[model samples]
Target: MSTAPETATHFRPVPVGLLRGRRPAVPGPAVPAGTGVEVRHPTRLNAMALDPSKIVGTAAADDGEPRGSGHPAGELFVVCDLFRTARVEIVPGSDEVTTTGHCSRPVLARHAASVMRELLGITDGLLVHTEGVDLPPHVGLGSSSATMASVAVAINELYGRPVEARRLIRFLVDNHGEEIDGRSDSLMPVQCIGGSAAAGLIPGSVQVVAGNAVPLLSAGLPADYRIVLAMPADPTEWDAQQSLQEEARHFDDFLRTGRRHAPDIAYRLIHQAWPALLEGEVREFGKLVFDYRFRMGSIKNCSFSHPRLLEFADAIEPAFTNGAADVLGLSSVGPLFFAVTRTEQKVTELFRDAGLRTFAARPWSEGYSVVKSW
Candidate 1:
């Protein structure tokens, strides 16, 4: 079949990381008087599911550390995709958790710490993670979200500021300085907003555009179908992320203004195209899929990509008889590409044959959580 690495679960790594062994669950930190305790939530690929290329921000949430003349107590935990999370230990004073693994854990941890510092309005002090998510790195998945969401769940518990799932997600949306540290909606919102009875009725369609980095995946995609996230083993860099922001400015205006820019308007139209796919409008939908991929192709990032995005389109462009692939896009600066194909067996075979790694997962519920609070 394939000659990829044997170590390559070549499948899902985030959740698998934890299966090998279990570390002691960490507890909440001690707090001072009158400080509001903070609790954290679980992590997911919420944003990526909507528009893989759009969810890139370099900010952390307020969960990892103490903040805003508030409570000193905080806690952290691992959420799902479920796996090897580094020993989640907290460094008080500074609000940040470290998720060290085989890949960019330490580096990501340090970056996450910085984001947490900013989000919580931390002035000088910093938070450090002695513990981390014990998982393989570089595989396309939401590891950063795991750490950040875990921190959020922990902080929420510590502060005693227990918010409803909607409220919790909204809090992150409003105050999230960046989506870089697992702030994407795929993690938490998928539970409340996905197949669950959270985001009202599932909309007719949910199309996320990578027009610019970090627009609104949950806001765009409808809740009808379960999410399928497929990632590879690479990521994007800082400069590319910035470029997405620039591209986003115009697209954001289009959404607000009800305007269209031919090429730019293509992906948005793809949103309109999805319902037709669900309703078995395969051929009609293929036209739109072609357009959407073309629109996204204008943008580029090193880590994440459609790889043979165009090639796939070419192969499947004419095969619209059986509810063909309705939508396909990259997960933010990714090598992690995703597609909503009607035929799983057929599509999976195609992907595997293409030498692309694949994983079979639906949207995860229970966004970032506090597994252990002492």
Candidate 2:
């Protein structure tokens, strides 16, 4: 459970190519027929749980209808080392697209085909395969976003990289509707751009401006720090539509009754947590994040819905207070808890003893990679 050997902080410029921009007039060079591409995209952990009220510039449009691409408020997230792989092969003369593995549903396959047809004007049959960690869906790991982004990246590559990662993200967000119900705010941009690691903005924060993820800080977390994830073995099956409805209610409630702790949460993030992370003060940063969660009344209410989850959280709270873990909090909606800890083994064991599935991951700064192409 001791700290791992210090690794050099990986720093690189955020890929401007992924920033919002107009699509190219002409596409990149076309690949040979039957071209194939495989991409590895990282999933993310919400360092600070999302609170709808805090989201800026993302209310109903002038027409009183929700915008197609919602703007996400400033939020911090870490791209974990866990990955989902997407392999796509273009099969000429075939009339249909087929998908297998993680997102193998017929509806999902049709969705993939629709994306390809719209983006690249390709009607060729696509043989798509995706795989990732055994984590349950809707556990705040950004699984759906990762899968969609990976497939999009692979398709883009097969077509000779004509589309920028940012445009792909924008397209995904704008087009997200009944096809995919549970979409994470800003997760597509993070995954498409290879996350904060690939963007070279580890331990930093981002806000979605006009559907683009703009980095608020470029600092990196201490390389030795680890993220310990505990996913419940039998998590409550969260319906995407139902969850969205709940969030909508929370947003409406926030608009009707403003959050009194908004300013405090913002101050802590911008002043305390940001500085702590910049100075490589892991414990201080973690404490600030853990504290930030409580300030958001919406998140607290959501957490209370799952009694067992609350019980588990109560059991693990002592680790953070006792200095064994730096940060301890839930990720997104529910049923998954993470700790920023030096003693990952101890934290992992604690979660497992509590009857949860546990795994320890390091913060990954780099984005997805095209591991293979043909």
Candidate 3:
């Protein structure tokens, strides 16, 4: 496979407005006989919505209703890490969609089918094997959306499409609207494709995704910034589709009451931390990091729900004491906490002191890449 096209052009800022209608479909570019392509999508740490108030009704809706009330407006920051990622391999000419890889699951297969039907309009056979990292469901690392984004990029490459990572993210958000509710589809392009961006709606639309990459005030993180992920040893992965769907429904109910929590989200992210990131003021940004952990979790009704998670969050305070970490927060919901440190090695030792599973990572700068094609 040839290298992935530079995504800067793909991620360029689109005009702020509701894009009308689905894009027209065209036949995928032909590939040489027996060609196989592999593509990679990174994982994310947190997705901080700037104006939490506008999160629900911002992106253009796919159902043909006016995208939203035409008033909601804000951005979201997709904090990404390359420590764990989804790598998907695509082999064409199969009779049906066949998948293999630790990240490969039934839902993933279904999503691939849906992508094929909706994006390529092809019912042809394709074998897709996902590799790298076991993405436990709802881990808050944007794994599900990253998986979809990875496969989407792979398929795009197969068709020789030069779609932007951001556009693919929006495309997935628009097409798989309902499937991504309560999930972080907006952040997928940020993680799998690289760069931390502030994505939001222009008005009259709702992004309606947990991981879809949205428009950003800025992309990428400051140089020399470091991150450490403290995940539970037993993720106790949820395998039940019904239970997950129930969670999604409850999440929708929670969003209906966004007024209750959106303000805090806005203050911490948009008013405070967003500037801290831009100005390279880690300490000021660190304070918002502490506040957001509690506030964002409360909105999810799971703040401080896990003893190990709390214990880790508490024990790592010594990091601030020792001049190692400048900021600390939980990633998404529960059981995955992160620290912004001067050095990854120092944070790793601190996690050791707390007896937690940990990995050293940094903010990813690049998005998806094609490693091989044969």
Candidate 4:
């Protein structure tokens, strides 16, 4: 019904050692009478953690067989702020992904309204309104993707449409997967939604999900811990699909060659990352994440990192041997680096005093879910 706020300033970064709870609910406009449904509890998107089985499913294109980790990746997760997930809801087995779903959540209602006011091509005076806590702005994480998938499911249910996973992924990909210079929003949600989200660069399959592993949960961390990110340089801009294609080629080659197999590693790590994160072996998880990103980058003759960022990564690697830190990488990409460490005030202060910013992330197994409809 109305435009989303111009900026997402309501979200606040966590304090160095605390799981900074989300900001107080910054309320938005009330849903106008019969305007549209509302969705809630969205999260940022996560990087794809590949599964070898899902990667090589028969449903995939025959161009070449994909390699899966036998399991999948991109499972363990966290949330910043999620306000709405909406739009299309195709019937299951209806094969509507390519045709039925809506892209651009947090903005859809406004888009619907604009169509009513200006386009007038097929208007019945339907106004879709979206409002909620502004999400954390970008650094490459999957905020928009989560928002879309959640809203798609919610609104689809509201309209009595049931979406199949495969089609839903495709719809999100089609609208969002554009060139950086063009219109795509990284289509980050495609893969973020399914076991392996829609990878525009890499081919995907809709057959039964591949892999034979189950995600395990833990009661709690051995001790309190915190995640710290180090931004060494400014973030960079690049085309996602092109980069993904290049990464996929390397992975394809790895599947082809038993020698130094990256595809297999990516697949294995996808499943492994879940337990590792649950068990709090987050330090190794970080390095594994870095290694995975690097190996994929090597396929394209690009390092998986910014030079300065790598330095920071190395600076923390030794801690792994001593069990000082777990997990590492640019929080989003290129310049920002992250490490998981037991909740030590000193560790937090280390990043803070060094003039780097940091925040806290809890283990989030919950991805995006539909909280309500109608």
Best by lDDT: 2
* Candidate number with the higher TM-score (1 or 4): 4
Q: After superposing candidate 2, which stretches have Cα over 4 Å from the reference? A: 1-34, 49-51, 54-69, 101-106, 177-212, 252-258
Tens digits of lDDT, candidate 1, 213-287: 122223232223233344433323332234234334333322222223343344534555445644545434434
Q: In candidate 2, what are the lDDT values of residues 21-127, reduced to their tens digit?
A: 22333352344434788888776776653333433233222244223333344445666778787788877778566775555333433454455555575566788
The total of clashing pairs for model 4 equals 34
Q: How high is each candidate's TM-score? A: 0.46, 0.75, 0.68, 0.50
Instruction: Write the number of the candidate with greater TM-score, choosing between 1 and 2.
Output: 2
Model 1 misplacement above 4 A: 1-104, 110-146, 162-290, 295-309, 312-322
Worst 10 residues of 2 by lDDT: 2-11
1-374: candidate 4 lDDT, tens digit per residue? 21112111121121111111111121221122222444553333232233321332222121242211122322322233223444332233432122123334424233222211221122233333333433232444544444434444444434333344444444333222222334321222112223222211112111112223222222233345555544433444444444444334333433332234446655555566546655655554555655554444421222343434444555544444455565444432334444556744555565565545555544333334445433
Question: Taking the candidates one at a time, how many backbone clashes does each contain?
Answer: 70, 6, 30, 34
Q: After superposition, how far is residue 65 of candidate 1 from its true place, in Å?
A: 19
Those runs of model 4 whose alpha carbons end farther than 4 Å from true positions after fitting are: 1-35, 41-48, 51-138, 164-176, 179-226, 229-233, 237-259, 263-307, 316-322, 330-336, 344-347, 352-355, 369-374
